[model samples]
Target: MGDPVTDPAPDGIDEGRRLIRLGGDKGLSLADRLAERFHRLTWRTPLHTLRLKGRYPLKLIAVPEDPILGDIARGTMLLEGVLSFRGEARDIETLDLSKPHPKPFAEYLQSFAWLRDLSTVATRARGAPIAEYLMGLWLTAHADTQGGIAWRPDMWGRRILAWTAHAPLILSSSDQIYRSKVLNALAKGALHLDRTADKAPAGAPRIAAWCGVVAAGLLIPGGEPRQAFGEAGLLRALGTGLFDDGGSVSRSPAMLLDSIQLLTLLQESYAARSAELPETVAVTLTRMVAALLGVAHADRGLSSWQGGGPASETQVAAVIEASGVRTRPLRQARDWGYQRLAAGTAVLIVDAAPPPIARL
Candidate 1:
């Protein structure tokens, strides 16, 4: 079989049309709008109050993973509750955990989601307890509110994955009470992901949300229903996010890498349960690997396309290695609209056609 027909029309046209129609008289009535407004107002008022007061969940669920690149473990040594990133340290308790954090620090905090890095260093012994402490701090300082960056769907998805992946490190404490709190919090996080995943913005964010839910479902006991829901959402996301040619809908090399990684995680999650890999997942993985190889340059790196930077050859090779799909690069990608030119050991890749109008 050949590649499926590429839709020349811009993406989201159908959705846009539906939204337009909904904006007409067929939309919600005035009373319904007023009720919605009232409900939103009530919801927001409390949330805003909570944000200002910084009231949060007192119980911690799982520890976030530390970044591979920061000196937080060393920095946290300086002050009892201080987390340092990029030469600046702030006491976790004093910072306004409810509002948006300042730049570099925010990025640092996000990286802190991968707390395993701290365990690899001299702070190995302190890693678990510190992780629990920081988590408790965040829970007490931020988790109760609903409108901050910490509560965003994507953030929640990330937190779930990070917590699940590093559960051992976070849950290592002898404190049974704290352990129970962490588990309960994880359950709540999974539930939140399930409820809010649909509202996550399209593409990678939605995929991440679904994948997190899938991971939670597979790892958490008695979670078959959540697992099924997650699998369904993930499959839907895969259908839209990937093209028949195995390329990403966004047509960006970077996104292709992300899709590959997402698939790998999903595959591993299923494998961990000794479950058969879903047929759709298996097939998609195969095609996506082929697509990645097809676009790869002779040097094993990708061409700069679709607002993506030139990827390092090492990075490309590593991604291929991680894919676990052994296949040669495709010589041509007609459906994806790319041409590969070769002369002896020299090679050049060119975009054969203009980007889809809709993407612009």
Candidate 2:
């Protein structure tokens, strides 16, 4: 991998990370950052926290399957008390939530997306017990607490979807009290998402935050209001995050893939409840999948662009399979700015769009 710094220009998101670490980020003024940090400070008050603690639905109205598959081998390692993400692993046999970790690893843990992967291999080993223990620790530590990485909207959203998607795996136990606690935690998470999904960092993070809101609304009883709010936010995000041709505003293949997978999970969640898919969500999925195929090589993998690597064929196939979008490969994607041309046995994929922007 070439350093985005020296091998090529760094991506805007990477640059943003650099600026944030230096406290020189231009996206948010100090006041803006502080305001974002405290938009719903009332949620964190001890009285409000106690009110949430007092009651919760004892069970989800339904359980939804996450179409994305988890790595069996990674799930096995997770059962062994370790989790690895972006080349960083933590021995979480017993992790302290207050302790700091590298950013990517921290987000990975807080997202609880691992629960999906672990669900796949959990029945074979002690996956259920391990999941319950770790989740209990998280609940104990962060109950109704706000701020920090754990409460970041994207991670919060992912965690809600994860908890809801694999409720059987994560909430499985004979202990009624523990079961109630997990259910209450899910309600609390959904409430937080309801109030703060828009506060997530823009682009994919914003999309992710909204995904959680929709998923919770769909699976939890009497969540019609959240579902409606989330769908509206998602529609607004689409106008900015996607071109008419459905390429990501970031112009990264990786981001496109992530968007497909995230939305697909939410789509399937809607399906599980036998509900009508929202028309805009349906339309966006179709266009994004077609745009993804346009960028794929004849062999079914994507070209690297905007600091994204050429994604693996297996990963791409899984996303498409899960998406269930049958739109043909895009030949000429306008505004998305890619053109696929072939003659004889030769193939050409052109980068027809403007250079990728860092902070779309």
Off by over 4 Å in 2: 1-55, 343-346, 356-358
Q: Which number leads on TM-score?
A: 2
Checking candidate 1 for backbone clashes, the offending pairs are: 10-358, 60-182, 61-182, 65-113, 65-114, 65-115, 66-114, 66-115
Q: Which structure among the candidates has the greatest lDDT?
A: 2
Query: All predictions: root-mean-square deviation over Cα?
Result: 8.7, 8.5
**Model 1 lDDT on a 0 to 1 scale:** 0.61
What are the lDDT figures for the candidates, one per model?
Answer: 0.61, 0.75
* Candidate 1 RMSD computed on C-alpha atoms after optimal superposition onto the true structure: 8.7
Encode model 1's per-residue lDDT on 1-360: one tens digit a residue.
844432222222233332111112333457866764564354346654433341224343223222223234654443365666656767756765555667657744642443534554435466677777777766776555455556555566666666765666677888877777767666666776776665555556677778878877777776689789998988887776666656665567777776676566556666666775578777777777776666678787887787766776776776566556666454455444555667777877766544532421
The C-alpha TM-scores of every prediction are 0.68, 0.84
